[model samples]
Each structure stands twice: as structure tokens, then as C-alpha cells.
Target chain A: MKNLLIFGVGLIGGSIALKVKKDAIFDRVIGVSRHNGRSLDDFVKKGMLDEIAVNVEEAISTANFIIIATPVAQTKNILKKIYPYLNADCLVTDVGSTKSEVMLDAAESLGDKFDQFIGSHPIAGSEKHGPDAADEKLFEGKNIIITPHSQANKVQLDCLWGFWECMGGIVSSMTPSQHDEIFSTVSHLPHLLAFALVNLINKKNSKDQLLEFAASGFRDFSRIAASSPEVWRDISLANKKAIISDLTLYKKEIDVLVEFIDNSQEGNLNDYLSKASSTRSEWAEDKK
Target chain B: MKNLLIFGVGLIGGSIALKVKKDAIFDRVIGVSRHNGRSLDDFVKKGMLDEIAVNVEEAISTANFIIIATPVAQTKNILKKIYPYLNADCLVTDVGSTKSEVMLDAAESLGDKFDQFIGSHPIAGSEKHGPDAADEKLFEGKNIIITPHSQANKVQLDCLWGFWECMGGIVSSMTPSQHDEIFSTVSHLPHLLAFALVNLINKKNSKDQLLEFAASGFRDFSRIAASSPEVWRDISLANKKAIISDLTLYKKEIDVLVEFIDNSQEGNLNDYLSKASSTRSEWAEDKK
Candidate 1:
């Protein structure tokens, strides 16, 4: 019987467990908790997992598929623990925001079995976390990116694509570098800006009073600032090079805008804002 | 009979018309369209306005209360137009995002009648616009800030407070400079950042490709970027000093974050993000 062993059954992993059980994709699904297993109890009570694996070695050895659904920082340690016990045909994949770093961690930790691993990022998440926040339909129609290294096993890569597809994700493949660059621009930079915006307000002498008047615009713009500190810290570090590059470019954009406002260049400022506004409006329209 | 004459029957004006009509707050509500009367047509047909003003002079002459809900750039011109015809007791107020500039405009245009004018900024709006997007419940439980000049008539100020309170607004008073400073930090800065971010993406060679993968975090964070160019241009210019100061402060925040990320200051970065995350979390929780 096929076995699916999931590491760190929080929002991402717990959702996967729920979906897998509903679809019966694997004969037995086992979870290994990263925390104190208090989060895992809900999944157990709900019958989302076939078992909570008490023995990591036994679970890894019997598993045909292993999914590492932990923070990027924990991926290397989890990879190291499972590498010795992994069967020859076991396909290992991880759901980490930054792929290049995770790819490096897998290469370092898995050694000879590195080809069996592929990096996946299901671009679906909420400010909320833990198993209690897991939703079975979280990945439905969401973009799930897979970043496979040059030495990745062709058969295992195909299996990884099918695995995400079966979870109702729109799966696409890209190189680890491409994945990191794209996400750094689209995701990492925005998160950093949000955190900084919140921190800027937090630093103000009138912070509490300022926050009291923050309306829907601030609410939506700062929503991502409420994301997990540890998770974002891991992402920020793992993808530092690309993120820093984007941040540098973004700072230049801000400086240009400031110059426009500073000089009272009404026409130039209007044109700049018009371009941004029209582009955003079109993007929002297209989203609908 | 008490008449409420509203200039620019768009989102803000139309919403005010709706609330006033539903509550029968005035004997007659008349609308003065800024554009062609096309947008005002639905409002008249829906019985939200008793009449669309045919003669600007007559409308101004008979009005007991005049609400200028037009864009900030047009406020000077609207005030200039109605100044000659305004009766001595006619209280004039505007719903502009920026207070100091609008206050200046009223001071310039109204001359001896300056005390009759009070600047009001209702801190409630949607990304949507025009009369069709108007809601009677728009001001329900929302903060309505009135920025009254020191020389302002106390009776007119009290009446203005009563007017907004009648429409279900929670009214508060502050000076024009204080209003500009508070909103500069909370609203204007966030908007400028959102616009700049969208423009950054627009400048990228892979704009469409990057936008395709921009998920919820990017979506929510950039939502304010879709605001009206003309409106934001007016706000940015009107509140230039405050906005620029905030932007400079925000840029420093960005620099600090970039330095943390660039040097791989893991502990410092984590602490910075944790503070933002926790502050945002507590604010969100309190909001609920």
C-alpha cells in the first residue's frame, strides 16, 4: 500500500492531509508534528490523517511520498532526518516560499537522494495559521509552482506535478532561480514593504492614535503585515539576494515619487499616478 | 424650508444625498453635477435628490446648507462660483481628503464669509466611484472629522456637527493642520506607496508575467493603487509637506529593513517583523 508521510502538519500540511483523505490519493497518510502535537490533535479527531507517526524512521522508510510542509528554515533538518530512511523510489517534495535556498538545503541534506526531491510553492495562504485554520479547498484553482533542479528525477517530477494537480492546484514548473526571482519581485518585496509600513507606524509617538484612524485603505495595504513573523523571517533570509535587489529598485521608485511631490511637479506626478492607477485598475478588472 | 445643495453628484456626494434623503434631513436636496448630468440622472430617478439644479445662481441663493463633495482640485472653483450668492447663514462644508489646502481654498474664496465654512473629511470610502456606487449606509459608524478655523462661527460649527451626526457619522473636531498631519501618516502615505508599487511592476519587462503570479498578499497590498489619479494627485499636492515628510520617514524605514536583510541580520530582522506582526495582529483583533 502506498504511504504519504507529511512533516509539519500546520495550515499547508493539514490542508493537504484533509484533501488527501477526501480523495483517498494514498492508502495511508501519516503526519509528523513540528510543534507539540497540540495542533495535530484536531486533525486526528477529524480523521484527516490515517495516523500520527510516532517513529520518524519507520514512517520515512515506508513512505512512497514525503511532503515537507514546514517553514523554509526547518527544511534542511527535516531533509537530514528523512534522507537515511528514505526508500529508493520515495519522492520528496517541499512547500517553501523560496525554492533556490530550499533546493540547496535538499542537495546538502539528501546527498545521493537529492534527485528524488522537487520544490513546490502553493501560493495560497492566509494571515491565519496552525491546523485549526486549515481549509480543504485552500489550493483549489491556486497557483502551485514547482521548481526542479537540473538533476531532478524525471519520473519523480511528473509525480510531483500530478500530486499538486490532484490537490486541485493549477501546477506549473520553473527553475529554482526563476521561482526565487519571480516570487522575490511579486511576493517578498510586498511583504517587506508591508512590515516596514506597520513598523513605521509602530515607531510613531502617536502610534495608537494614528492606528485608531487607519481606514480600509490601510487595512488592506497592511493586511499581510499580520503574517507569521517566523515564517516571513525565514522567507526574507532564504531569498535575501533577490529580495534585496527588488527592495533597492523599489526604493528608487519611492525616491522618484518623492521628487515629483517635492518639486510640485503636478503634471509629472499625475502621469506617474495615472500609469500606476490604470495598470492596477486593469489588473483588478482582469482578475474579475 | 431648509435646503441641502450638493455640488458634484458622484460617489461622495451621491452617498450624502442618499443618507439625507432616507432620513428626510432637509426639506429639499438639490444636486449640482460637475460633469454632464448623466451620473446624476440615476440619483434623481431614484428619488435621492429632489431636483438636479438647472440654475446654479438660484440653487446657491436658496440653499441653507451647501456641501461641496467634488474632488479637491475643483473645490476652489466651486467655492468661487457659489460665494457671491451664498446667504449669510448658509453654512458651507466640504468632504475633502486633505484639510489644510481645502481650508486655505475656502479662506481665499469665501473672504469675509470664511467663518461660515468648515472643512469636513469623512474617513469612509470605497475603491468604487460615481453615483451608482453610492450607499446610504456609507457614513454609518464612520468617523467624520471637521477641521474648523479658529475664527469659525461657533453656531455654524455646531450646526455642521449636527448635520453629520444626523447622517449617522461620529463627528470630531480638529484644526486643519492637525487633520493634515494625522491623515498624512495614516492615509496619504499608504496610497502613495501603493501607487509607486504598481508603477514599479508596470516598469518591469515581465510585467504581465509577474502580475499573473501576484497572489492575495500582492492583491490586498496593492488594492489602494487603483484609486483615481486626479483625486490622489490633488491629495498629494494639497498635503505635500506632510506627505513628503512621511515619505522621507518611510524611506528610512525601508533602508533599515534593507540593511537588515542585506547583512543577514536574522535576529534584528525577526524582531522588526515580529513587532509589526504583533501590532497588526492586536489592531485587527481589536477591530473585530
Candidate 2:
């Protein structure tokens, strides 16, 4: 009988279990919770998981597939624990936001067994977290990126692609560095900016007053600021190099804008705004 | 019969016409279009306007009220054209985004008749513009800020308040400078940041590649970047002082975050993210 073991079954992990269970992808789905199995009780009750894992070694030894769904920071420790018991045929992957660090951690922790592990990032989530927030359709039509290192097992990599596809994700592959760089520009940088904007407002002496009139524009622009701090903190630290580089480039852009505004350079300002406005409108149109 | 003349009858003016016509608030609603009556013809056919004015001076001389619902840059020009025709009892106001500049334009163009003009900002809009986007309920339950200069007519100010309230707005008062300052932080600065971020991505050689992976977070954070360039350009210039000040402050916040990430200061980074996350979460909660 096939066994699928999920470590740290929160939103990402719980949702995967829900999808896998609904499709009967495995004979048994087991969850090894980071929260001492307390959160896994609901998953079992809902039939999303067959059982909560009491013995990590036993679960890893029997598993055909293992998914590390914890915050990126805990990935190394999870990989270390599972390495000793992982069967040769068992394939391991993670749903981490940043790929490079996870790839490095998997390499260090798994050693000779590193070829069994792959790095995957399903670009789907919400500000909400935990098992309660999990949905079977969380990944439907979403982008699931896999960053497979050169040493990864070919059969395992193909299986990982098939797993994400079966769960309705449009799976794509990229180099680990490429994934980090692209996400740093598209996701990480925007999140940091949102966080910074919110904190900027908080620093105001009239913070409550400023917030009172924040309106829809402010609401939408700052929505990501409400994301899980612990999760983002992990992402920020794990992807520090790319994020810092992007942030520095972003600061240069801000500087140009400030100069335009300070000098009342109307023509330059108009050109800058027009470029952004048109590009964003085109992107939004294509999305629709 | 009370006559209401609305110059530059686009989204804001067209919506006002719709509400006024629906409620029979005026005997006649005359539109003086910025697009030379082409847009107003449809409004007239739809019964949102009583007629399209051929002679601007005649319309202004006979009207009990005038709403200069044009772009901020056009406010001074519109004020200049109507000054010679405005009567003593005629109350004038505008639906401009920036209040201080509009207030200054009114003072400059209308001379002694400036007291007849109140600077108003209806804190309501969408990215969509033009007459087709007008909604009678656009101002329903929205904040209508009227920035009355200290030398303004009290009776006219009260009448202006009544007019907006009748149009389904919750009216409030503030000085023009205060209005500009608050909106500069809450609205203007966020807009510039969104614009800058989008432009930053566009500058990258891998722009389309990067944009391909911009998920919901980037979508929401950059949504305001899709706003009208012409409108935002005027706003950036009109409230340049306050927006520049806020942008400078925002840069400092970015610097602190960068330092934490660069130094691998996990605690500081976590603390920074935690503050933003909690503040945004609380604000979102309050919104609900």
C-alpha cells in the first residue's frame, strides 16, 4: 500500500492532503504535525488524512512520497529527521516560497539521499493559515514551480511534476536561482513594500487618523501586509540575498520618482506614470 | 426654477447629474462639457441632464450652483472662464482630488468671488473614467470632504454641505492643507509607490518573464498603478510637498528593513514584519 507522509500540516500541507484524499492518490495519507499532532486531529476527523503520525521513522520508512510543508526555516530540521528513515524509492519535496535555501538545506541534510528531494513552490495561498483555512481547490489552475537540482532523480522529478498536475496545478520547472530571482521581483519585493508601507503609516503620530481615511486604494495596496509574519520572516531571511538586491534596485527607482516630484518635472513625471499605468493596465487586461 | 450648471461633465459631473435628476433636486441640470458637448449628448438623451449648454456664460449667470468636475489641472482654467459670469448667490464647488491646489486656484481665479467656491474631494472613484462609468450611487455612504477657506461664506458652506449630503455623501470639514496632507500619506504616496514598483519591473530585461509570475499579492499591491496617468500626474504635482515628505519618510522605513535583512538580524526583521502584520490585521478587522 502506498503511503504519503506530510510534515507540518498547516494550510499548504492540509490542502494537499484534502486534494490527495479526494482523489484517492494514496492508500494512506499520514500527517506528522509540527504542533504536536493537535492540529492533525481535525484533518483525520474530516477524512483528509488517514491518521496522525505518532512515529516519524515508521512513517518515513513506509512512505512513497514525503512533503515538507513547514515555513522555510524549519525545512532543514525536517529534512534532517526524515533522512535517516527515508526509503530509496521515497521521493521528497517541499512547498516553500523560496527555492534556493530549501535546495541548499535539502542537500546538506539529506547528503547521499539528496537526489530523492525536489524543491516545489505552489504560488497559491492567502493571508489566512492553518488547517481551517485549507481547501481542496486551493491550487486549482495555480502555478506550481519546481526547482530541481542537477543531482535529483529523474523518475522522482517526473513523479513530482505528475503529483502537482494531478492536483490541478500547472507545473513548471526553473533553476533554483532563477526561481528565487523571479519571485524576489514579483512576490517578495511587493510583500516587503506592503509591509514597509503599513509600518510607515504605523509610525505616524496620527496613525489612527491616517488609517481612518485609508479607503479602498490603501486597503488593496496594503492587503499583503496582513500576511503571516512568521512565514514572511522565514521567507525574508531564507531569500535574503535576492530580496536585498531587488530592494536596492527598487530604492533607485524610488529615488528617480522622488527627484521628479521634488523638482516638479511634470513631463518626466507624466512619462513615468504613463509607462507604469499602461503596463499595469495591460497586465490586468491579460489576466482577465 | 433652480438651475445647476456642471462644467466638464465626465464621471463625477455625470454622476451628480444623475442623482440630481433622479431626486428632482434642480429644475434644470445644464452640462458644459470639457469634451465639447459630445459626451453630454448621451447624458441628455439618458435624462441625466436637462440640456447641454451652448453658451457657458449664460449658463453660469443663471445657475444657482456650479460644479467644476474637471481634472485638477483644469480647475484654474475652468474657474477663470466662469468668474465673470458667477452671481453673488451662486455657490461653486469642485470634486478635485487635491484640495489645497484647487483652493489656491479658486482664490486666484475667482478673486472676491472665491468665497462662493468650496474645495471638495469626494473620496470615491474607480480606475474607470468618462461619462459611461458614472453611477448615481457613486457617492453613497462615501466621505465627502469640504475644505472651506477661513474667509468663505458660512451660508454658502452650509448649503454646499447640504448639497453633498443630499447626493448621499457623509460630509465633513477640514482645512485645505490638512486635507492635502492626509490624502498625501494615505492616497498619493501609495499611488507613487505602486507606480514606481511597476516601473521597476518594466526596467528589468526579463520584464515579461517576471510579470508572468506576478501572483495575487503583486496584483493587489500594484492595482493602483493602473490608475489614470493624467490624473495621477496632476495629483503628484498638486500635492508634491506632502507626497515628497511622505516618500522621504517611507525611504527611511525601507532603509531600516534593508539593514535588518542585510545584517541577518532575524529578531529585528521578525519584529518589523510583526508590527506591520498586526497593524494591518487590526485595521482590516476594524474595516470589517
Candidate 3:
């Protein structure tokens, strides 16, 4: 009977545990809560977790698999705390937005044991948070990118892939640097722009009336801005270099557009808008 | 029997025709298509329009209510064309995104008959265009702002309000300058940003990969970029002064945010994001 231990279970972690346990994928499941430990009590009350562990070290010896499901910022600290106690052959992985820093930190801190760590990020989330927000089918039909560590054992990497596959995720692999670079614009920059636009509108002289009449467009454009500030703060900082590059690039585009609008250059503005319009219409997206 | 002649019928005018015909708000409905004369035939075939008109002069003499549903850039020309034929008692209004320029042109060109024209913008729209996209209930529970001419008769303004109200629209009033300023930031700026961001992403080093991975966030964030290029081109150009001012203000906001992200200033980023997050949560919006 294999044991699966989940650390800092929130939306991502709790959902994984729920899905795995509901499917009876593992014999024993344990969760160590970092969010006030209140969620662990709820999990126990709800009969989801087989048990709860306060000290990760006490739980490490018995677990064959450890999933760190915390924010990316805490990845290094958590890995450091458990490395001395983790079972030699334990399959360790994480579900964080950024991968390069976490993988680098693991390589530096875990020494020869770096093979045990695999960096994975499931591109499925909503603005909601907390354990209660966890859904058993959260990862169903979603893309999960695993940033494989080169020194990691091949069999352990396969096992991690299988775990995500078993939980209904479509598994793919990419280097940590590639993952960060790709997501920097596709996800992080969009969130930053949304946040910035919302704040700009908020601070405007006509904010009260502006917000009052802000309809579906403003609502949809700024929806991601409603996300947890602390989480985004961590993400922007963790993935700073790539995100800054994206922001810088986007800044240039916006400046050029501003000139077109300012100069009332109709032809240039039309061509600029036509590019975006045609591109958006062509892009494959699941309809809202 | 009141005849409502709608020049430049597409989504906005066609929708008004459909709703008013459905409710029997007017005795006659006529649509002149800017996209094509074919849509007018379709509207008549669908029993939304009582007849189609090719010449605004031929239509204007008979219309008790004349709605200029053309693009903002065409407002001055349309006003010049129809003012010569309009009945003194007729209430002429427009459905354009920008109002100040249209109203100013109305005052300048309509000469002593400026009071016959009212600048109104229904705060309801969709990305879809043309007669096929028309919805009878589009104006239901939506706002329509009338930037009334100061020299306009109170009775004529009330008639204008009643006309929109008859189409199931709630009517309000504002100065043309006030309407332009508010919408420049809320409506025009968002569309500009969406377009610019989409183009920026399109021109990126990883356009294909970025788009393939673009999910719900990108979909919602870039939605307005899918708006009609010609329509937006006209709007941004027509309201150049106000939109440019807003673009500049938003540029400043983006610069400040870039500074934080570049410096990895987590504390300031958190607070800035927190303000937006909290504000969005408080605002009434459709759930993501």
C-alpha cells in the first residue's frame, strides 16, 4: 500500500487529493496544511484525508509520494525543510506557476537527490481560492506541463507523469526556462495588464461614474484583476525577468498605438486594429 | 402615424427596428444600409422594416423620428445631407460612440436647426455587426445617454427619451464633452488596449506557441480586439483628443506597474494589485 502525502493543500493541492482519493488511486492519503491548519480539520471532517500531519518530517518516512502544492515563492523553503527527512526514493513534485527558480533551487539544495524533484504546472485555475474551492475534476481535460530535471530518475519522472494523467490531465514536458518564458506573456502579462488597467480606471477623475457605467467589456477585460493580489505579487516577482521582458515588449506596442490614436492616423490605426481583429478571430479558444 | 427612418442600419439600427416593430412603437420603419442594400432587403423580408430607403432626403421628409445609426466619422456628412429635408417638428438623433464632435458639427452645419438634432449613445452593444446580428431585446434594461443640444426644446428632448424608452432602453442625459471623456477611458481605451495587446502578442517571438496556449484569460482579455476595425478606427479618430488623453494616463499607469515588476517590488505590487482586486470584487460584474 503506497502512501501519498500532500503539502499546503489549497485549490490546487486539495483538488488533487480529492480527485486521487475519490478514484481510490492510493492506499493512504495525508495532508499537511499551511493555511492555519483549519483546512486539514475540514478535510478530516469531510472524510477526504486518511490523516493529517503537523510535522512534515514525521510524515516523510511513511510516504512514498510527496506533492508540494503551495505558491511558487515557498517552493525552495518547503523543499529545504523536507529534503533531510524524505525517503530516498520518494517521488517529489510541485504544482507552481513558475518552474525555473524552483528547479534551480531544488538542484542547489537537494544535491545528488535532485532526481527526486519534478516541476509541474497545471494551467487550470479560477479567481477562487482556499480548500473549499477545490474541485475533484479541476484538472480534468487540462494541460499540465512538467519541467523535468535532467538528473531526475527516468522511472520517477514517468511515475509523476502517470499520476497527472491518472488525474485526467493531458501531460506534456518542457524545460523550466521555456515554461517560464511561454507563460510570462500568455498568462502573467495579461494578468498584469488587467490589474494595471483596472487600477488606472480606479484612480481616474471620473472613477465613480466610470465604474458605474462599466459594462461587459470592462468587466471581462478586468476579470483577472480580481484575482488574489498576494498570489499575483509572488508570481510577478518569481517570474520577474521573463515578465519584465513581456511587459517591455507590450509597452512598445501600446506606445505605437497611442501615437496612432493621438495623431488620428486612421489608416495606420485601422491596419493595426485589423491585425489584432483577424488574429483574435483566428485564435482557437473555448467559447464563454 | 410616426415613421422612424434609420440611416445606416446594422446591429444598432436593425435591433431598434426589430424591437420597435415587435412592440409596434412606430407606424412605419425604414432602414438604409451602409454595409449593403442587401441587409435592408433582409430586414424588410423579416418584417422588421416597413420599407427601405436609398436616399436620406427621400426618407427624411416623411420621418417623424430619424436615427443616424452610421459610424461617428460619417455623422457630419449625414447631418449635412438630411438637415435640408427634415421637418421642423421631427426629432433627429444619432447612435454614435463619440458625441462631442458630432454635436459640434451639428451646431456648425445644421445652422439654425441645431435643436432638431440630439446626440445619443445607447450603452449596449456586442462585437457582432450587421443586420444578421441584430437582437430585438438588445436594449432591454440598458442605458442610452442623450447629449442634448443646449438650444434643444425640452419637448423634443423628452420625445428623444421616449423613443429610446419605447425600444426598452433606459434613457439618461449628459453633456457631449462629458460623454466623450467618460467613454474614452471606459470603452475606447479598453478596446484600444485589447487590440494593442493582441497585436503585441501576435508580433512576439512565440506567437504560434503563445496563441496555442492562450486560454480563458487571453480570450476575455482580447475579446474587444475582435471588434470591427473600421468602426473602432472611426471612433478612436473621431474622439482623438479624449482617447489620446486616456491612452496617456493609462501609459503612465503601465509605466508605474512596469517599474514595480522590473524592480521585483513585491510590497508595492501587492498593494497596487490589492486595490484593483478589491475594487473589482465590489463592482457588479458577471461571474468569471
Candidate 4:
């Protein structure tokens, strides 16, 4: 893309900007954010962004591509605000974790402009946040899921796929609904469990002692519990339909396991745990 | 101590044997197992053990310090078999994952020999097992929980503490009940959640799709799910009371969190997540 405009320049946004600039893939990179701050200035100083713009319309006038790199919860409002100003030929896409809701929001706010929207999620990020945490090659050797609805433009979809490929992403395509369902199980549910687990330990009377004696297993298990609460809360609520579905399923499984343990049924418990361990081992083998 | 006899020379037992032998802390080390195997012979060849013994009574006959490194479920039977053979003034101890049950088992089988039993748990071990996986410095810079019951001999207790300290474990004493409770929250509960999480996803119709798209978060969160099913099943059952208590409380927290997400109550969800994130950060700081 010759001209690129990016909104919400945080970890994902900043990384993309830095990477594209390093690869010399874009001729002009325009940055737009809610607030002007040292971070934005640092981005410009680092040559990731050519300039920061205060006017959305002005930024859209010259752009052939736009990426909404904000939380899923903010998708619709931002789409509504920028829809009128978007260039007719420019394609718009997002980097939100949840896809179906963002697609619904795009369809609602953008109307005819919805054809330009492609919902994408790059499964590469650290628990750290902000532009300072952005890595020049964060998207290298990562998986990127592009969720396109029925109305999505074929050319734009392929173009977005190629764009991510240029940044070294292994791109895959699926329906927005399927994307949400899969992620809710693999990504969102794990975060929900970690947050609750950490909170439970903290509220216990033996909190200090528990933390003191916690070993490497505890550290690895709860590392995600230190993730940005704001980002996770937004993702959890915005994707509530998928997450709640997984959570309900998860609750049922946990209840069954608890009953087996309480009754001291060694064979049943072993069968349950063995199934999980074998599956995990199989997956790890595939990963290798 | 001299003439150490270790039963069930797996990872923990083998590691202690290697460390004590390397440090020249013991005059003789004898490994006892229920089966004759290549792994036991490998241990002898590695110099982790001076010999493998089939006669538990003959092995116990000359030992001043004996370490039972078997699973918690096997504690009572092993104690019963060795109690009659243990020499007077010789101190017997264990490396079981659960404390109170093992202590009770030691008491029941040993009878008047109860004072010779000191229950301890070294909070350092990998998921790896067997003689080949043993590390001479496994316990170095690790915490060892020494739980000696009311009837435990004072000299034996002190001697066990010093023994662990000599292997670089910073030893601390706590009631067996406290050790069970603390580990239930930090260790057992997380393992339970991981096993259930993996099983839930595996049983799903889209299991392959979910595993294919799973990310680093899923990998780290479910690493413990790859642990020994039999070992964890034993731990879960042996420490059922503490685990059930934690699981019940954990179920409640998850229910409330699920409710908040379903209703999209940003304030409540944010507050709950914030508490966990902050507590994790605080603990991480303490670790540093």
C-alpha cells in the first residue's frame, strides 16, 4: 500500500507501523489517536509514523488503506465516526481479537462501506502494552485470522491477506462466527480462568503464604493473570456470547471432575486426566 | 547422614541420591524398588545409588536415615512393610506430595515408631520423571516444607531440616494442615483447571480447529495439563479436603465473573480483573 492510515496506535498498531516502515512497504504512514502524547512523538522520532493527524477526514482523504487497531468494544463507534470521511476506493480492516461483533458493528455503522471491512486477528502479542512495547518483527512467523462476512469484497479480502503475508504472517480465512467460536475456546476462556484463579488466591486468608510457597508451576500457570485488565474485560464483554458458551461448557466439565475427586474414584479421574494429557502431548508433537 | 536408604528412586529420590553422593554427604546410598528394571540399573551406573536392593528389611537393617520417595497412596503399605525392620533410633521420613494423610499413614503403620517419621515436601521438581531426569542440584535455591507432627522426634526434625539445607533448600516448618491448604490453592487447583480446560476443548466437535489456532497463552496455561495423570490423580484424591474447598470457592468466583461478562457490566468486570492483575503484579515484584 502506498498510503496507510492507522488509528489507536498501541502495541498492535505500533508494531505494524514499525514493521511496515522497516520493510519499506508503504510510501506514507499517517497516525491518528484519541490523545497526543510522548508515545506518538516517540513513534514519529523512531520513523514508524510520518505524522500524527488531529482531523480524521484529512487523514482519510489521501489514504488508500486504513487499519482500526483498537479494542473490539470500540470498533462500532470508531467506524461510525470515520465512515463518512473514508475514501471510496480505500479498504478498511481491524486488528480486534473478537470478530463477529466487530463485523456486526461494521455492518451497522458503515452500511455500504461495510464491503471495505475485513476483521483480522493476529495471534501474536505479549502481556505488555503501549507503543514502547512494540517489536519491529512482532508479526513475523505469526498466525493471522481474517474473518470476512458475506458482503466483504473479494479483492479487498485478498489484498488484506497479501498485506499480512508481506509482514510475514501465515494468513488463514474463516467466517466471523467460526473465528469467534474457536478463539473463545482457545484464547478468551484461558484468560477468563486465569483472572478468576488469581483473584481466588488473593482473596483467601492464606494469600501471603500461598504466594510465598508458589513454585515455577504457579508462575507459568498464572502468567496470563498479569495481562491488561482493561483489554481483557473489553474482549470478554464484547464477545460475551462465545465466551459465556465456552464458560458454561467449562463449568460442566469441572463439576464432573470435582465429583469424581470427591468420591475418590481413581479410575474415572485417571481416565479424565489421561485423555487431556494425551491430547496435549499429541498437540505438542504436531507443534514440534 | 550415613547409610541412607531410599524407596522408590524416581526423580526426587534419584536427585537426592545424586546430590548427597556428589557432596560426599553420605557414606552409603541404597535404592529400593518393587521391580527390577533398566532405569534402576542406570541409576546405579550413574553413581546416584551404590546398589539396588530387593530386600526392604535388609536395606533398612543398617540405615540411620530412610527417605520414602513414593506416591502418597503407597505410604501406608510401605510404612507397614518397613516398620518392623527399621532399627531403633533410626529416623524415617517421606517426600510425599500430600502431608497430613502421609503423616496419618506413618502413625498408623509405625505405631510406637511414629516419632521416627518426619514428613517433608520439597517445593522443587520438574514434570520430568525417572532416574535419567534427576538433577543433582534440583533442590538448590528451592523451598522445602518440613511438616513434623506433634509426636515427631525433635532431633530427627532438626536433622531433616539440616539435611535439606545442606542440599541448598531453604527449609521452613509448618503444620501439615497449613501445607495442604496452601498447596491446594496454588498448585492443585491450577492443575485441576488445566486438565479440565484441555479435556473440554478436546471433547469439542471442532477440537482440531481449536488446537490448530491455539496461541502462546494456551500453551503456557495448559503446560501443566501435560503432567502425569496418575501422579496428579493421586495428589487430588490424597488431598481431597483442601482441593475440594478450593474448587468450591473457585467455582463461585468463576460463576460471578461469568455473570458480569454475560451482562456486560464493565465496572464489575473491570474491578474483578483489576484485583487479580494487581495482585499478580505485586507477587511478581516480590519475586524480583
**CA RMSD of each candidate after superposition:** 1.4, 1.3, 2.1, 1.7
Residue lDDT tens for model 2, B1-288: 899999877888888998999999999999986654455677788898889888889999999999988777888998999999999999999999889888888899999898899888999888778888989999998899999998888899999999999999999899999899999999998899999999999999999988888999999999999998889989998998999899899989889989998888889988999999999999999878
Model 1 per-residue lDDT tens digits across residues A1-288: 999999988889989999999999999999997654465666787898888888889999999999998777888999999988999999999998999988888999999999999989999987678788888899999999999888988888889999999999999999988888889988988888999999999999989888888889999999999888888888888888888888889989999988999999999999999999898888888877
**Any runs in candidate 3 off by more than 4 Å, and if so which?**
A285-288, B54-56, B285-288
DockQ of each: 0.89, 0.89, 0.80, 0.86
User: Which digits, one per residue and each the tens of the lDDT, describe model 3 over residues A154-243?
Assistant: 899899999999989989899999899989888888899888888988888788888877778888898888888988998888898998
Q: Which residue pairs show backbone clashes in model 1?
A: none
Residue B150 lDDT, candidate 2, scale 0-100: 86
Per-candidate local distance difference test: 0.90, 0.90, 0.85, 0.88
Better of 2 and 3 by lDDT: 2
Candidate achieving higher DockQ, 2 or 3: 2
Considering only chain B, report the TM-score of each candidate against the true chain B: 0.97, 0.97, 0.94, 0.96
Q: Any residue pairs clashing in model 4, and if so which?
A: none
DockQ of candidate 4, scored on C-alphas against the true complex (2 decimals): 0.86
lDDT of 4 at A254: 82
Return the clash pairs for model 2, or none: none
C-alpha root-mean-square deviation, candidate 2: 1.3
Fnat of all models, as shown = 0.92, 0.91, 0.84, 0.86
List ranges where model 2 is wrong by over 4 Å: B35-37
User: Weakest 10 consecutive residues, lDDT, candidate 2 chain B?
Assistant: B33-42
